[model samples]
Structure formats: structure tokens, C-alpha cells
Target chain A: MDRQAWTTLFHRLLFTSAVWIVLSGTDAKALAVGAFAVPAATWLSLRLLPGRDRLVLWRFLRHFPSFVGGSLQGGVDVARRAISPGMPLLPGWVEVPVRLPDGGRVALGAELSLMPGTLAAGVRGDRLLVHLLDTDAGFENAIPREEAAIAAMILGTGKEVGP
Target chain B: MNDLATYAFTSIGLFFFVAGSVGFLRFPDVFSRLHALTKADNLGLGFIALGIAFQAESWRLVALLFLIWGLMLLAAGTMSQLIARDALRERDGR
Candidate 1:
């Protein structure tokens, strides 16, 4: 394996080990089992989905707070709209032009789905089809903002990559 | 103080869960129901995990709770996409 591949393997090992410790705790017997299990799982993971782009941790950390807050707000918004007697909803679909690569696009879709009133339904051509609970809920601004954040985290560059 | 936080968080979490269920029953279509179930239930689980974390005896258990919540968020996000895609396809008669 090349240096990049090795680095990816090492990171995967570290992550799988952390998951193992979380799952089985730090007991000696559990560690003994994990000794066999962790590496096997990491190897299987690499085989199934080899690392291509590394997520920039600091970038992700910087954006994490806002992402959490947005999703929380999303939950509250949906709950409020759902329980209201009027049941105010203006549900519809909107297409946002996709600018990032596949990995960044998937991350963007997932993050947008967790944000207020937006669920990414599918991709068409170079645009993402997002379902909105309310067309006028200001998703116009939110979607682009989230796309930039995911692009920064995955690609390490905030610049728009495509026209 | 800890008990107070636990109770408060748990109550808020349960409230969200109930709201999600209500939304599921009230929402008119599959897409709307998906919104309620995925978003509200995830936040509900997050708060409930936070509440449990407050009462956890060790940091390890707290970490475990957080990991579980994070995993759930990822799963819910991905599943919502798959479901929404299928629903759209079905509606289009594809």
C-alpha cells in the first residue's frame, strides 16, 4: 500500500478500536476478543469501502456546533408545525445545483436532510432534488450554506467547484 | 442538580417523541411523515441520550451514549433519503 493508503488504514484501525472499546468496554476479556475483532473489521471495511477522501477533522469540528443547532431547530420546527391546529404546510420540491464531488454531495445531502424542513430526495443530472416542508422557509439560503460547509470539510476548500 | 437535569432532559425527550408520533398520524403523505419521524425522533433520541449521559457513572458510558446517538443520526439521515427516493419513484409510476 502507498503512504496515503497506509494512513487511511491506520485511521480506520484507530476508529474501529474506539468503537470496540465503546461496545465492549475496557475489560481484559473484552480487549482479548477485540484483539481479534478490531483488525478484522477494519480490514473488511477497507475492502468494502476503501478510503478516498479524508474528512478534515478541524473543519468538521468548526462546523459541528452549527450543524447540531440547525438539526435541533429542524426538529422543533417540524414538531411545532405538526402539532399546530392549522397544520400549516407548503410542502414541495426544489432543485439545487450540485457543485461538489460524489462524497461531498452525499455528505451535503445527509446534512441537508437533518437541517430544517429539507430532505434530499434524489439527484437529477447535476442537481440535487430536495423536498421542503415549506417552500418559503428560507431553504434557499440554508442549502447553499450547508453545501459550502460540507465542501470545506470533505474537499478542504470552500470554493465552488462546478458551474 | 444531576437528578434535576436528568428529569428535565428526559421530559423534553419524551415530549419530542410524542410529537413525532402525532406528526406521523397527522401528516398527509409519506414524505411529510418521513420528515416527522426522522427529524423529530432523532432529536428525541439525542435528548434522551443526553439525559442518560448525565446519570452515567463513568465517562465511558457517556461516550457510548453519544456514539449511539451519532450513529442513529447518520442512519436516520441515510434511511430518510432511501425512503424519500422510493416514494418519489412510486409516485412517478416508475
Candidate 2:
């Protein structure tokens, strides 16, 4: 097998083994069943979601901290608004044209949805229909920033104009 | 010390949960409520998981807690999209 295939296989095995340990715990009797089940499940998963795009682990790792921080901010921001008497929400929809390709577009949509005050409602052509908790939130500026990061994470550079 | 930590985290989790509930009640519309629900649930459950992680006997439990949280995040994102889309479609219709 090629190096990429081997890497994928190794990661898959490690993930399945960890799952097996979690499910079976320290029980010795279940080890036998897990030995058969884990590989079968891994194979099935691989078949269903074949790793088409080579996920750049280093880039992903680099991007993860920001994503986590964004999500936490999202939670706290909503909670604050929820408890506030003003409940200042100027909710509206904005269609932003994205520069990323299909995969990057989907990732950006999901990632933005997890962030504060943004929900990727739909996508038509190159524009993503986003719902905002506050319309004046400067989502146009903020989204492109995130799109840059996501584009880097997926396409290895923000300059790549995705088809 | 651990007990104190647990209480702090748990309370914070519960606080977010309550906030989410309040948002659900007070938000003007469906899209806003979803915004509250998804974000609040992610942080609420995350804090709760951290609380439990402090008391966990093994790393496996911590990993499992996080795994469950990740699954919830995925569900929240997908559900929010679905609900928001439906709401938008209805709005456009009128």
C-alpha cells in the first residue's frame, strides 16, 4: 500500500482500538469479541466514508485551537444575551459569496454554525445563506476571516480559488 | 478541592442550560432560538463533562465524555441548519 493508505489504516486502527477499549473496558471476556468486532466495524466505516481527501493533520491541528475558542465564545455570547433583559437580537439573513471549493464550503458552513451568532442556513451556488443573531454583527467581515482559516486548513492556502 | 471544582463546573454548566432555556422562551423567532439552543447546549454539556472529567477514575472516561460531546456538536450543527432552512423557506413563501 502507498504511504497515505498506510497512514489512513494506522489511524483507523488506532481509533477503533480506542473505541473498543472504551466499550469493553477492562473486561477480559469481551476482548475476544472486540478483536473481531473492531476490525469489522473499521472496515465498514472505511468503505462507507472512504478517505478521498488527504486530511492534513498538521494544518488541522494548527486550526483547532481557534475553532474551540470560537465555539466557547459562541456559547457564552448566547448565554449572556439569553439572560439579559434587553435580549438585544436584530436577527436577519445575509448571503455571503465564498471563495472556497465544495469541501471547504461545507466545512466553513459547519464551522460558522458552531460559532457565535452565526447559522449557515443554506447554500446556493457560491453564496452561503447565513442567519445571524444580530444583523449588525459584521458577519461579512468575520465570516471571510473564518473562511480564510478554513480555506487554509483544507486547501493549505487561502489563495487557492476553489472550483 | 476536587469537590469544589466539580461543583463550580457543574453549576456553570447548569447556568448555561438555564440561559438556553430562557433564550428559547424569550427569543423572537425560530432561528434565534436555535442559535441559543445549539451554542448553550455545546458549552453547557462541555462544562458538565469537564466537571465529570475531574472525578473520572480513568482517562478512558474523559475521552468518552469528549466523544459524546463531539457527537452532540455534530447533531446540534445539523439540526440547526435543518430548522433554520425550514424557517427560511416558510418566510420566503409568505
Candidate 3:
């Protein structure tokens, strides 16, 4: 395996082991089995999904907290909207032009959809169709900032190969 | 104290679930309904997991709760995207 491949494999092994630890409740006997099982699973996974994106750990670490915060805030915002006696909803679709490549764009779309007020509708060329629960929710600026964060974390080296 | 915290978290979680249901029923269109369900459920489940975690005996259970919530979030996001895309396509076709 090449350097990149090895790196991916190692990361996958670490992740699978952690999963096993969590799932087995850190039981010593369970971990004994997991020591072997996790590596085998990682190997199988690598074979099934080869040549995937190289995950930059530092970038992921940096933005992960913000992502969690955003998601929590998203939940609160939507909960408040849902419970309001006077439902204040101004539903509209907005097309935002994004510079991120195809993969990054998809990631951004998925991320945006998970948020409280925004749902990504479709991708047409360089623009993404986004549905807003309320246009007044200030997504115009918010989306771009998220786009930048996603690009930095997942895009790796600021290079776009396609789309 | 532990019981109080657990009750508080669980109530909040149930409250969000109720709110989401109301939004789902009252919202006019598919897109809006999707918004309500996805957002409220994400938080609802999170709070519920947190409540359960507080009462859990081991750290592993807490980790498992978080893992479940993370997986739910991913599923919600993917499912919403698929539904929204289909709805948009149908609208365009009309």
C-alpha cells in the first residue's frame, strides 16, 4: 500500500477500535475480541471502499466543535419555531452560487440540510438550490461561512479536480 | 439530583418531539414539514440520549448514546436531502 493508503487504513483501524470499545462498554473480554475484530473489519472496509478522500485529522478536529455547536443551535431554533403559537414561517428557495467542487459541494449541501432552517433542494451547475424555513434567518451569509469551513476541513490543499 | 437532571432532560426531549409533531401537522408543504421533523428530532434525540447517559453506569454507555445521536443526525440529513430533491424534481416537472 502507498503512503496515503496506509494512512487511511491506520485511521480506519483506530476508528473501528474506538467503535468496538464504545459498543462493548469497555469490557475487558470484549476488547480482547475487538483487538482482532476491529483490524479485520478495517481491512475489509478498506477493500470495499478504496481510494477514498484522505481525511485531514487536524482540520476535522478544529471544525468539529463548531459543527456540534451549529447543530445544537439548529435544534433550538427549529424547536422554538415549532412550538410558537404564531408560526412565523416565510418559506422560500434561494440559489447560492458556490465555488467548492462537486464532492465539497455535496458535503456542504448535506451539512446545510442538517441545520435547523435550511434544506438543500438540488444542485444545478455551480449553484445549489437551498430551501429556507425563513428567508429572514440570515442564511445568505451563514451558508457562505459554512461553505468556507467545509472547504477548509474536507477539501484538502484547496484544489478542485472537478465540478 | 440525578433524578431531577434526568427528568429535566427527558422532558425537554419529549417537548421537542411534541413541537416537531405539531410543526409536521401544521406545515403546509413537504419542504417545511421536512424542516420541522429533521431539526426537532435531532435535538429531541440528543436530549434524550443525554438524559439516559446521566443515569448510565459506565462511560461506554454515554459514548454509545452520542454515537447513536450522531448516526441519527447523519441519517436525517441524507433522508431530508433525498426527499427534498425528489420534491423539487416533481415541482419542476409540473
Candidate 4:
């Protein structure tokens, strides 16, 4: 499905499920209700919540795989931190240059922090200060992957590097 | 025991959300606000999730709650990073 339909479907599902929880409908009924409710809500929201752009939603889904991949990588890092025998973790702040606008920078910073071993220490202009626990593990050094992931997520392509 | 445990979790979660909001209101800058939000808000949400998880009637609800919790966690962490970075950026410009 195209991005718009997918997003509309998601919106429907989220609301229907939310409603089902509060009301406590039976299993089959809840599923049917939600199935109907979500699409209805989507239609209503589309009609009512005017001027809402779906670009970010589209971009987000496009970048979703990488985000999940990054999150999994982060989980592994946490495992490493938990299990690593005795080596002292070298924590350092590294700068990540963002070529996108402030909004994109904001989006990237938020997305990256979901990964393990990294906390957004600071941001200056379009540059984000990322604190990494295991700088020597090659993850922090290979900043391009994170950047590329963010790029895919926010801008949706390499060509539209910045705006 | 279960009732008491449930209440305790729920209360703690409510307390956390309140404390985080208070901090957000009182804090001077974006950085401090992010600091307030990340730990407390998430922990609060965690507590809320735990409370809900306990009350969940079926595996489906439990699984759905967990998924929602996971998404919330992602949002909290990411948004905080964005806030922290922007605060630093503004700080640097001045």
C-alpha cells in the first residue's frame, strides 16, 4: 500500500484499539468494532483535522526498518554492557553534524537516542552531541550509518540531503 | 497482595507523571526539561504500563500494552534527545 493509505489505516487501528480497551468489548466484537472504527476515524480526521501533512508519516515509515535495525543494534550494545567482563567503558561525547534544518535535526536526535549506549548530550545548531559508552566498539566511529538512517527517515532520500 | 501491588504501581506512576510535569513547568531551559522528562516521565509511563499489564485480561491485551509501552519508550527517548540537542544549539549560538 502507498504511504497515505497505510497511515490512514494505522490511525484507524490506534483509535479503535484505544476505544476497545476503555469499553471492554468481547473479542470478535472488539476486532470488528476496531476494524470499522479505525477507518471511520481516519475518514473523520481527514475531513476535520485539516492541513495535516502526511509527509513525515511517510518518511517515518520509510525509515522504520533502519530505526528498528538501529534499536536492535542498541539492544545488543546493552547486552554487551551488561555482560562485558571487566573492560572499562570509555564514555565520550562526539559531535554529529546535521545538514538538515532544525526540525530534521530534532527528529534525528530523538530517533538516535532510542538506541542503546547513546544519549543525546547536547545539540548546537544542526550539530548533535551524542554520548557513547563504548567508543572503541566501532559503532560510535561509524557515525554514517546513524546519519544515513536519520536521512532516510526524515528526508526520505539521499538526494534531498538538506532543506 | 495483588490489589495493594496494583494500587502501589498506579500511584507511583501517577506521582511520576505529576513530578515530571512540575519539573517541566519549573525548569528554566530545554535541557533541564528534557532531563525532567526522560527519566521521570518514562518511569511513570513504565509504572502505568505495569499497572495495566497486571490488570490485562488476556494475552492479546498484554501484548498490545507491551507494544504501546515500547512505542512510548521510543518516543520519550527520541524526543528528549531532540530537545537536548536543540537546547545546546541555542546555547551555543548565544
Candidate 5:
């Protein structure tokens, strides 16, 4: 493997080891099992889905707070609308042009679906078909902002990081 | 103080869980119901995990709780997309 692939393998191994430690705790006996299991799992993971893109950690960290805040708002918004007397809903679909690469697009779709008032339904060509809980809920602005964030996270700002 | 926090957090979590269920029953279509179920339940689980984390005796247990919540968020986000996509495809008769 090249340097980038080596880096990906290292990161994946580190991640899998961390997961094993978290799941099994720090007991020597558990770690003895993990000594065999962790590498096996990491190898299996790489075989199943080799890393295509590197995540920009600082960008993700910068966006993490807002993402959490948005998810909280989304949960509360849906709950309030659910129990309200009027049951106000203007559900419909809107197609937004997608600019990110494949991995970034998947991340964008997942993130947008978890955000307030929007659910990513499907993809048609280069446009993402989004279902809005309320068309007037101002998602016209939200989706683009989210897309920009995801791009920054996956693609970086004007300088791509991964091979 | 920790007990009080646990109670408060869990109660809020329970409220969201109940609200999610209500929305699931009340929403008109599959997409909307998924919107309710996934979003609300994710938040609910997060709060409950936070509450439980407070009671955890060790930092490892707390970390595990956080990991669980993070996994739930990813799972719910991806699962909602898959379900929504399938529903959309079915609706379009494709």
C-alpha cells in the first residue's frame, strides 16, 4: 500500500482498537482477546469498505456544536408539531443541486435528514430530492449551509486532502 | 445533585420518546413518520445516555455510553435515508 493507504490502515486500526477497548474495558483478559480480535476486525473493515476520503478533523470539530444544536432543535420541532392541535404540516419535496463528491453527498444526505424540518428522500441525477416538513420553515437556507459544512469536512476548503 | 440530574434528564428523554411515538401514530405518511420516529428517538436516547452516564462509576463506562449514543445517531441518520429513499421509489412506481 502507498502512504495514504498506510495512513488509512493505521487510522482504521486505531479506531477499531479504541472500539474494542471501549466495549471490553481495560481488563488484561479482555485485552488478550482484543489482541487477536482488533486486528482481525480492522482487516475485515478495510476489506469491506476501504477508505476513500480522509475526514478533516478540525473542520468536523468546528461544525460539531452546530450539528448537535441542530439535531436538538429538530427533535424538539418534530415533537412539538406532533402534539400540537392543528397538526400543522406542509409536507412536500424540493430538489437541490448537489455539488459534493459521492462520500460527501452521502454525509450531506445523512446530516440533512437529521436536521430540523428536512429529510433527504432520494437522488435524481446531480440533485438531491429532499422532503420538507414545512416548505416555509426556511430550509431553503439550511440545506446549502449544511452542504457547505459537509464539503468543508470531507473535501476541505479549496484544498482536497485525500487521494 | 447527580440523582436530581439523572431524574431530570431521563424525564426529558421519556417525554421525547412519548412524543416520537405520538408522532409516529399521527403522521400521515411513511416519510413523515420516519422523520418523527428517527429524530425524536435519537434525541431521546442521547438524553437517556447522558443520564445514565452520570450514574456510571468509571470513565470507561461513560465513554462507552457516549460511543453508543454516537453509533445510534449514525444508524438512525443512515437508516432514515434508506427508508425514505425506498418509500420515495415506491411512491414514484419505479
Candidate 6:
């Protein structure tokens, strides 16, 4: 198969294997099983899903690192709030208009929610209902800072929200 | 060694949850409050889950717990997006 196809195959394998290990309830052999099973599943899925054979590994993997990074960033934000609960938390719900297709936008939204201290409260068409931690002082003050962070994590550089 | 590590992780996890809740209650807006819940709840749950995982005798049980968590994250995240999208649409129109 082509390069993208192979890449896609590998990813599907990892995801499938992860599911397997979890379901099997055998951590003792998990790493071992995961190592091989993941790849096996990837190959099998590639064969099953007929299409352009165009694998979006980077398309998805690009977000994987953000998962860890964003979570850590969020963790710090949480810690900050804990230390100073009354610290002028900027709280407000603003809609982030999305130009992304329905699926892409939906995917992005879900990922954002996974980030610390942000919630995808609602969605109507391309509009997103986002609630920031503190909005009292400023939409200028709070929303932009956090939204920007959220945008970067979700949309990558091209999707950064305009200031 | 593993037990100690698990305990430490649990402590940190609990700490984050409390912090998030404090922010949620104290914070001034819907957005901030949401963040407080999103951030803190996950950590709180993570710790509790980790403790159980470490203490449990069966990998299958732990795996089940993890599976549930993954699904919850998926569901919650999607719901968050839907709400955000709808809210934004209403404001721009009005």
C-alpha cells in the first residue's frame, strides 16, 4: 500500500489495541499485546475501509501532543485558581464562530472541552458556545487570552482566533 | 514503590479538583465556571480512578474503569462543543 495508507493502518492498530488491552483486563500482557495488536488492527482496518487510501495521520497526530500539553497547561491554570480563588476570574460565555466544516469543527470543539477550564456549552451551526473562567472584568480581559489558547490547541496555527 | 507513586498521584489529582471547584464557585462568569468544573472534575476523577487501579488486583477491572473514563471524556467533550456552537450562533444573530 501507499505511505498514507500504511500510516493510517498503524494508527488504527494502536487505537484498536488500546481498546483491546482495556477490555481484556490484562495489564501484565498489555504492553506486549498492545505492541503487536495495535499494528495488526491498523492493517485490518485499512483493508476494511475502502476509500482514497489517504491517511490523515498528521491530521490526527497533530492533536495528540496537544492533548498532553493542553492538559498540563490546564492543570497549571487550575492550580492557580486554587491558590487564589478570588483572583479576578474572567468569566463569560462567548461564541467562537467556526469556519471549519461541521465534522472538523465538532472534532475541534470536543478537543477543546478536554482542555482544562473550558467547556463547549453549546453549538448552533458554525457558532460555538464557549464559557471562559472569568468574564466580569473583560471579554477583552479574559476571553481572548483563554480562547486564543483554546484555538491554538484545536485549530493549530492557521485557525488561531483573530485578535 | 508503585503504591507510593499511586498515592502521590492521587493526592495531586484531588488537589486539582478542589482547586477547580473553588474557581468555579468563586469565578464570575459562565465560562470561568465551566473551566473550573472541566479542569477540577477530571483531576478529581483521575485520582480516584488511579487509586483504584493501583490497588485493584485485576487488570480487567482497571481497564474497564479506563474505558468508561475514555467514553465519558468523549461524550462530555462533544456536548461542550454543541453548546458552545449554539450559544455563539444566537449572540451574533441578535
Per model, how much of the real contact set is kept? 0.66, 0.69, 0.67, 0.22, 0.72, 0.70
Predicted candidate 3, C-alpha RMSD? 2.9
Model 1 misplaced regions, further than 4 Å = none
lDDT of 5 at B61: 95
Each candidate structure's TM-score, on Cα atoms with residue i matched to residue i, is: 0.96, 0.90, 0.88, 0.50, 0.94, 0.60
lDDT of 3 by residue, B1-94 (tens): 8888899999999988888898899887999999888888887898999888889988888999999998998888888888999999998894
What would the per-residue lDDT of candidate 3 be over residues A87-122, giving only the tens digit for each residue? 888999889888876667777887887665898877
lDDT of 6 by residue, B6-90 (tens): 8887887788778877776776554555566665666567666777688777777787776776676677666555555555566
What level of docking quality does candidate 4 show? incorrect
Runs in model 3 deviating more than 4 A are A26-37, A47-52, A157-163
Q: Residue B60 of model 2: what lDDT? A: 81
Q: Model 5, A53-142: lDDT tens per residue?
A: 668778999999999999999999999999998988889889998888876777888888779989987699989989988888886568
How many clashing pairs does model 4 include? 6
Candidate 6's C-alpha runs over 4 A off are A1-21, A25-59, A82-85, A93-95, A123-125, A134-163, B28-30, B47-66, B82-94
* Chain A accuracy as TM-score for every candidate: 0.92, 0.82, 0.79, 0.58, 0.89, 0.52
Q: List the residue pairs that clash in candidate 4.
A: A12-A38, A110-B78, A123-B85, A123-B89, A124-B89, A125-B89
CA shift at A52, candidate 3, in angstroms? 5.1
lDDT by residue (B1-94, candidate 4, tens digit) is: 7677779988877777776676556544455445445545565676787787788777667767766776787788766775665666676685
lDDT of 3 at A78: 74
Q: What does DockQ give for each predicted structure?
A: 0.81, 0.75, 0.66, 0.15, 0.83, 0.45
DockQ ranking, high to low: 5, 1, 2, 3, 6, 4
Predicted structure 5: lDDT: 0.88
* Tens-digit lDDT string for candidate 1 (A64-130): 8998899899999999999999998989998989888876787787888888999988888889989
Which 10-residue window in model 3 chain B sums to the lowest lDDT? B35-44
lDDT per residue, candidate 2, A108-130, as tens digits?
77778879889888786779999
Which candidate leads the pack in TM-score? 1
Candidate 6: RMSD to truth: 6.6
RMSD for each of the candidates: 1.4, 2.4, 2.9, 8.6, 2.6, 6.6
DockQ of candidate 3 against the true complex: 0.66
TM-score of model 3 (CA atoms)? 0.88
